[model samples]
Target: MTHFKSQVFLILNELPSGECIGYGELAKQAGFPGYARQVGHLMKNLPKDSKLPWHRVVNSQRKISFAENTDAYWQQRHKLESEGWIIVGNKLTLNEFDQKEER
Candidate 1:
């Protein structure tokens, strides 16, 4: 894997179950502060059977990035909610689950 991808994976691996970070924050933690899109790309390409908690990453708005009603969208929401996250409509209140990014 490339260094950048490796960094992204490392960050994903470190996220505690039920916790989440934004795409931009993941990029920043991966040493690419302005590369949020790259982080999203890396996430999209993760292997289908991969154990990484890709669902734990959201948009900067603290919302699921996937389109509602799609399988991916529901899957992410289900995984997160199963882990104690509160989803109101398409947005998750990050603070309720202690998953909000520290400022």
Candidate 2:
């Protein structure tokens, strides 16, 4: 695997349950600050059964990247909700769900 992919994978693997990072944040944490779009693309292509918590990664706006009410959107919503996420109106509704806040 490329160094970028390796770093990203390591970060993802270590990501705690119910926690999330934005795509740009993930790229920056992986040491590739401007590669947010690339990180999203790479995540899009991950295997359907992959164990990576891709759903835990949100957009910079801290919302589900998928369109509202689509299958992908609902799927991601379900996964996140199961993790105690409180999303409403396409937004990660509660302060607790905000990744920027101190937990």
Candidate 3:
């Protein structure tokens, strides 16, 4: 794994269940500001069966990155919802449900 990928994974694991971090925020925290797409690329390479908290990351708009009907997106949604997150319309607002202590 790349340094940035490991950093992003750490950030995701730190999130409390039911909460999420935006791709932009993750990239910044991983020392790659303005590189959310790079963050996404990192996520895309995560081992499918890995125990890392992949569901804890999302787009800055607080929306899941993939379509709902697709297995990947549905699995993400299911995992988040199981942890008490609610998907409202096309957005998954972490502002109201984040588990991390605000920095």
Candidate 4:
């Protein structure tokens, strides 16, 4: 895998549960600003059975990118909700579900 993609996966794999992020935020965290589309592309191409937390990612607008009512859309929604996320008016803010770590 390319270095950038590898970095993205590493960051993604370590994402804390109950935390959501945006595509742009994911790209920026991976040290590639303005590469939100690339992050989205990676998400789309992930293996069907991949264990990556792709459901934790949303759009820059704090909204799910999937078409409303589509299977993909519902699937993403279900996953997020199952993780204790409450989609308010179809919007989910990054870090909305974050909890303070017990350092």
Which prediction has the highest TM-score against the true structure?
A: 1
Q: Give the winner by lDDT.
A: 1
Candidate 1, residue 51: Cα displacement in angstroms equals 0.6
Please list the C-alpha lDDT of all candidates, in the order they appear.
Answer: 0.89, 0.88, 0.80, 0.85
Ranked by lDDT from best down, the candidates are 1, 2, 4, 3
- 20 Cα displacement, candidate 4 (Å): 0.8
Encode model 1's per-residue lDDT on 1-103: one tens digit a residue: 8899999999899899878899999999989899999999888888899999999999988899899979999999999998888999878875453654453
Q: Candidates' TM-scores? A: 0.90, 0.88, 0.82, 0.86
- Backbone clash pairs for candidate 1 read none
Worst 10 residues of 4 by lDDT: 94-103
Model 2, span 4-89: residue lDDT tens: 99899899989998888899999999999999998999899899999998888899888999999699899999998888788887
Candidate 4 RMSD to the correct structure: 3.5
Candidate 2 TM-score versus the reference: 0.88
Better of 1 and 2 by lDDT: 1
Higher-TM-score candidate of 1 and 4:
1
Rank by TM-score, highest first.
Answer: 1, 2, 4, 3
lDDT value, candidate 2, whole model: 0.88
Please provide, for model 4 over 13-32, each residue's C-alpha lDDT reduced to its tens digit, 9 standing for 90 to 100. 99988877889888999999
Q: For candidate 3, write residues 1-103 as lDDT tens digits.
A: 6787778888877877766888899899878899899888878888878888888888988899998778989888888878877788657754434445454
